[model samples]
Target: MNLALLFGEDFVSAEQAVLTGRRLAHLKSVLKVAEGSVVPVGLVNGDIGTGHVLQLTDTQATLQVELPEPPPSPLPLTMVLAMPRPKMFRRVLQTCATLGVKDIWLINSYKVEKSFWQTPWLSEENLRENMVLGLEQARDTLMPRVHIRKLFKPFVEDELPALLKNTHALVAHPGTGTPCPVHINAPATLCIGPEGGFIPYEVEKLVEAGCEAVHLGRRILRVETAVPVLVSRLFDACS
Candidate 1:
């Protein structure tokens, strides 16, 4: 896992415990780590450490370990996106994690098909599967929290402010006041609309909510691609 690599430790060990989805497959088909092998280890949110391969058998693999330091500071931005199509959602989640975004708020929108909401991909197990894949890709141990808001206005006008108290906020809209800033300096919460895009009323409410309307370009970018592209661009600006 990249988080382990990023932290320089294995995620599981003796005394304390952790669960791994692919441990069996990893031991068998993936790493083929043998007994007595020293694998770097760390806890998801705790500390980076080392896990000694105590035993490796078909039943299971156990690790003897040592804990290390905590994980690094994460990206300062939180993304607010209109829930996209099923296939694109997986990519978006993975991209966000790969880029160190740990807080994602996926909400419903007018352009979002009603049928899309019922997808099995939103199930807890499926959501975690995608999130873990993203974490594994990033080599980051910290898992970003994902939230869903079905009703748009209430989430925007009510709960959003408290959630965004300390962060700068921006909403990506086409034909906005100014092109999206090349890079943003402070911590921010960015909201991006669904493919067909946010209607005038939605943009107005976001503006009233204190979000600066920023456009990435003259043309619109699909949500899945736009989310990562915008986040990466902002990461560079802030870094």
Candidate 2:
């Protein structure tokens, strides 16, 4: 964990917090910290800062926290994606958070299995857990929001158009005519399909909804691989 993400429950006072469970283990074993040691820390959906160890024990570690700086700027992109395989979903969610993607939509597609949505990772607790892991890895405090849309047509026809308003919208399909735009660095909404790519009908619907279909050359990447590649191409994070 690059940052110790503290929640409201972790705090004893305005400037103090306690670490336990995985974070406590990491402190004792991985970081090998002691009383008086300092570590990077951040409050969930708050700010990034430092925590000075005040007390340590097997059960918990108490810290004096100082939160003065804001977290990393979020990418100005809304990701609409087909639900990936259960095994890959958690990692993909985490990857999205780490990459500064604040808005994510998991939508259905022709190739997406009905069973994919049954995964426990979609639970509110699990979702927060994975997102927290991602935030910790990125040393970012702002939490990402995930929206689920199991019905394809209703969402595309009913909701997607307004979402695309005033933003460059694109769908990533390998054989499409236009290449995915590079470093546009502006607000955008990107639609990516399932494992075998979107059926022609789905692509057409997305296109009709204002997304210009685009490509990332000949490579057929999995959903997990495609997301980061497409995001990086769309914006320069360093800027």
* RMSD to the hidden true structure, all candidates: 3.5, 0.8
Per-candidate TM-scores read: 0.85, 0.98
Candidate 2 lDDT, 172-237, residue by residue in tens:
999988999999999999999999999999999999999999999988998899999999999986
Off by over 4 Å in 1: 3-21, 237-239
What is the C-alpha RMSD, rounded to one decimal, of candidate 1?
3.5
Q: Which digits, one per residue and each the tens of the lDDT, describe model 1 over residues 131-216?
A: 76776666566778889888889988997777677887889998887877756656989999999888889888888888889888
Which residues of candidate 2, in runs, are more than 4 Å off?
none
What lDDT score goes with residue 182 in model 2? 96
Which structure among the candidates has the greatest lDDT? 2
Candidate 1 CA-lDDT value: 0.74
TM-score of 1: 0.85
lDDT of model 2 at position 171: 98
